[model samples]
Target: MATDFWASTHYKRWIVDRATLRQARADDLLYIDDPEHLAFLAIYFAEVVGKLGKKLRLPQRAIATATVFFRRFYLKNSYCETDPFIVIAACCYVAAKAEECPAHIKNVVSDARQIFCHEPYNIKHFPSDNSKLAEMEFYLVDDLECDLTVFHPYRTLLALCKSGNGSEDASAQEEEAGEVGAGIPADDGPRYWGTGQGQLELPPNGLQTAWFIVNDTYRSELCLLYPPHLIAIAALYLTCVFHPATHETVSAVLAASSSAPASSSASTTPDPPPRRSSRQAAERKKPAQDPLEFLAELNVSLPLIATIAQEIISMYTLWDRYKEDSGSVATPDSSRNGEDDGPVVTPALLTVVLMKMREARLLEIAHPSSGRPVAVNKMLERTQAAG
Candidate 1:
């Protein structure tokens, strides 16, 4: 991991242009008739990867990084060109190592096979051999250009909490709530709340919701669009707009935690406050500014932050409608459901992918000579057998 994000490989190479990303995705769009379905497929694959990582007891950092790896891989190479499951497995294997909590190739393969063995997806017998996983790992690394370190918003959120900007007063919050109307606008753009500037404090409930929004932002292109700290600010800002709470909530919670240790059975004893050090007293004497005040001072654009927040909101909206089988209407918590929410990985989709892979393989094998395309039924049979 680079000490300076601006000087790191993530900043130098991975932050891609929108047009460039769009052009790269064009290849995948060609094969996938319904682009929306393909997006759902990517989301499904990310969920599986996350689950696989968790079952192995890896940290959320590793899982989140692995999910980003999977998304980045598909961005460069289409699902039809390579197997999604193998790529997912490889990403998990590499991300575990990258995040300093390594998982062996054998463990990755076995755990993955065990997890998805009876799942709805066509994956019955995935790559169990360590050698196979290692090979796919090489491909994943190459696709990401060996940029393994990913800067997540987890640390940024923690920094905000420590800075005291993670909680806000009720009067300040209510005013914000009234201005924005809702978190995001019903139309395409974001509605600017009074002067489009404020102290930018998030209450405990708002902070928690912001944390959820940050997690959900991983499912969108915001990670690629902006820096980690900016994303954190955006999530908190959106939380305050959509669901505003007061700083007293967090203060009360902290007070409860501190007071709980003194009393037996934790009854309301109105625990006495502890004596503060001179340094602590001095620190408190200074005025507290917005935790994200530094962000405002920097060259960061408020409009860009708002746009990133809007995009994440849009992704959640799509996620609600992503489930084809359930036909459930989208609620705010729709994404909290299990993997069965979206469209299942149909054999037909796999078959199409298999046919494309076969064609590419044939082209590689018969470089000097021409050969006819393989039959669909035989190709499907071969794909199933390989799995």
Candidate 2:
């Protein structure tokens, strides 16, 4: 795996522009008119990945990787071309290997059957044979171009928080020592967020909140459009905005930190530094830096971060309007089951669209003169039959 994202296949080949991503989905959009329908499906499947990963005892990193794989596969292929249930299982199986925590193929298929066989899906067509999942894994890898190394935002978020905390400690020490012009140099680049800017203090739940935001971004096309680090920063930016540090919040954070357990080796270590007087401590204390200002000073493209943030916000809006029970799209005013509101998209509606896509695909295969692009899996099957 490439350590640097700049040199990784994710940055080079997978980071698509918005217009290009839209164009890529044009074929699928022909069958499913409302693009939000697709977004809803993506969100639904992401949750499926999470649930299955949890059941398998897979790490969050592997779960995230599986979700990305599922999304990437659909970017190139239509939903009707292949069974999404099989793809979901295949993605999990492949991601486990990619993350060096492989799950048994039998276990993956069994768990996936349990998920898709109930509720809104009630999918009876799910393949019972383990070989079906094994076969789909080949197509999945082919679609991904063997680019299995996905860099998630979790690590980047932690790194950012760590650097911010380190900078705050250094700033306080420098203030106490009466150092002149003491801080990260301007030439230190984007690695450190506290360079020249004031110190950043994350709220008590800021990092945790940012983590959830990052997980949600996978539901949108932001993962395919922007780099992981930018998405992480955008998540952190949203966290700071949503959970700003008030006096009470800060006091709670201080209290929690003070009550944390000391290191086990503390008794063996020497710590004889003279305690600072309360007056001296008060003089060294500095006001927490505004996270927004700190982020603004970083050497990154603000416009890109803003765009990513907007995309995440849009995802949340879609999630709000989604209803898993309804099979068809409903108008806002249409009341169902005594409910005043209706969903914009539903699994039933997506199922109808997929059925149309499948019917169209059958017709195209029967009449090759239609000139529509054949799904890769179909072409492979045709080749095998010819042989």
Candidate 3:
């Protein structure tokens, strides 16, 4: 795989537009009701993968990569056609390999079986058969088209924060706390690099907050819609809006925005202007600038970044609602057939997927010719025993 993100298959083949994404979601609606349901299930699946990774003591990047793998797999295949729980389990195994943290298939299956013990139907989801997980691995790999390298925003954000201009040098701090003004020379600010001191640097926690924000963005389509660096910029922009120490920076930038639109667009850079000839373009292409200067010159859309921030924000809001409304407690003995009759504290997304899995398993048992479905005979024996 090409290590360069710009030239990678992720950027060229996987980064998709919204309308196309909407159509894909529509196709998956056989199992999911609407866009809201799809997003809710995505959040649940991410949590499942994360919790599994945490239990295994895997790094957060590994968990994040597994989550991305799960999402990418569903983008191509319907969740109903295949068992999401199994796919999620397989993703953790494959992601462990992809991230240089190999996990044995048996251990992965064992962890998942214990993790999802509260599965509604008790259909023995996350089967212990190592072969099942190994077989699912093939499907996951094929559906993902063997593109495993995920470019995240974490490194990009770190690079921006470490730059001298991006963060103020120690010597400049003593000049003035927050009242100093630095002006652009005749040719500086958005096209020209400025040596002045007025540029804003993020607070101590700004980088950390931006990192979390980028992590949360994976719950949505931001990873597939925008490049990693732009997502980092959006996180930084949101940090400026929310973090008390960085408020003044956003205020200053907004105040500056009234005069020109440069800073607002820093989060979403536009393409370079067209050139007459390849030779002329090669000759005129400017040398890369430091991160700060690049930020200043970027032609990003302020509104687009704002929209991305809002998407992350909305996911959190939904998360809170799901937790509050569902109480989010799991019970192994809870009724498996349908809703719990009363206030319905169980999350609908979880409920829906569980029901679908239960139904698919029943269909397989009723029609046993369907190539060794997860324990059809055992499930039938249970029904006979219960009856």
**lDDT by candidate, in order shown:** 0.61, 0.69, 0.62
| Predicted structure 1: clash tally | 3
Off by over 4 Å in 2: 162-199, 244-282, 326-344, 367-376, 379-387
RMSD of 3: 13.6
Position 176, candidate 3: lDDT: 18
Q: CA lDDT of 303 in candidate 1?
A: 86
lDDT of 3 by residue, 329-384 (tens): 45423344353421222444465555664466456556767566544323223222
TM-scores of the candidates in the order shown: 0.65, 0.75, 0.67
- Candidates ranked by lDDT: 2, 3, 1
Global local distance difference test of model 2:
0.69
- Please identify model 1 stretches exceeding 4 Å from their true place: 163-201, 246-299, 324-387
Q: Tell me how candidate 1 scores on lDDT.
A: 0.61
The lowest-lDDT stretch of 10 consecutive residues in candidate 3 is 176-185
Per-residue lDDT of 330 in model 2:
36
